[model samples]
Target: MPQRLVAVSFNAPTSELAGRVTGQGATLRDIPGTLFLGGGVPVAVDGTSIAGIGVGGAPSGDLDEKYARAGLATIR
Candidate 1:
């Protein structure tokens, strides 16, 4: 799950749980592709993505995303 989260965070403009699912719905689960699940977010600088972060084991996707964002804040 953490691997998928990281994949989606780095590949998509936003996380799938954030409502921006990448590719086709069926294809979303494909490995080696954008996982598009959730609990992930991109690390951006001046509006461009430089890296990505993901969180797992949170109670919910929202919480995971929040945690990821918080992690990003430290480096920003």
Candidate 2:
């Protein structure tokens, strides 16, 4: 889900993309393939997104996102 989110975020808005995905009768967890809720964040270098990081096993999706952001911050 994070991977898909990052990919979609590259081309569209993450909030809107999430809404569209949910509107289509699918969830971040229910989507077929590698999908995650809020742990996936794109890694950008020099204003260019080159990769992404995904964190899991957190208590909540918000925590996962926070953790992922922390990790990205370290790299920056």
Candidate 3:
């Protein structure tokens, strides 16, 4: 699927898991696509909570970053 249009959601730290998922890409009309990355788990709110991390996929590194952020945006 188109990277910008694709959104992959994984575990997210309660505080920061939402930025890289859907907020920006949902509105950015210029972006070719979005690849939101995630592990399908909820990021623990506690510091001891595991780190929810993943990378956005795209033709370019910049686009990848954007998509990665899109996925994170999906986190609750």
| TM-score of every prediction relative to native | 0.58, 0.63, 0.30
Measured with C-alpha atoms, the lDDT of residue 65 in candidate 1 is 70
Predicted structure with the largest TM-score when compared to the true one: 2
Q: Which of the numbered candidates is closest to the native, going by highest lDDT?
A: 2
Worst ten-residue run, lDDT, model 2?
A: 7-16
lDDT of 2 by residue, 1-76 (tens): 4553564346332333455554545455365664535566777667666777667788976677678779879988
Model 1 C-alpha lDDT per residue in residues 22-41, reported as the tens digit of each score:
45664434545444445677
- Residues 21-57, candidate 3, lDDT per residue (tens digit)? 4454454333354333332223345433343433434
Q: Considering TM-score, where higher is better, how would the candidates rank from best to worst?
A: 2, 1, 3
Better of 1 and 3 by lDDT: 1
Clashing pairs in 1: none
lDDT of residue 72 for candidate 2: 74
Candidate 2 lDDT for residue 39: 61
Candidate models: Cα lDDT each:
0.59, 0.60, 0.38
Write down the lDDT that model 2 would get. Answer: 0.60
Query: How much is 42 displaced in model 3, in angstroms?
Result: 14
Instruction: Return the lDDT, model 3, position 33.
Output: 42
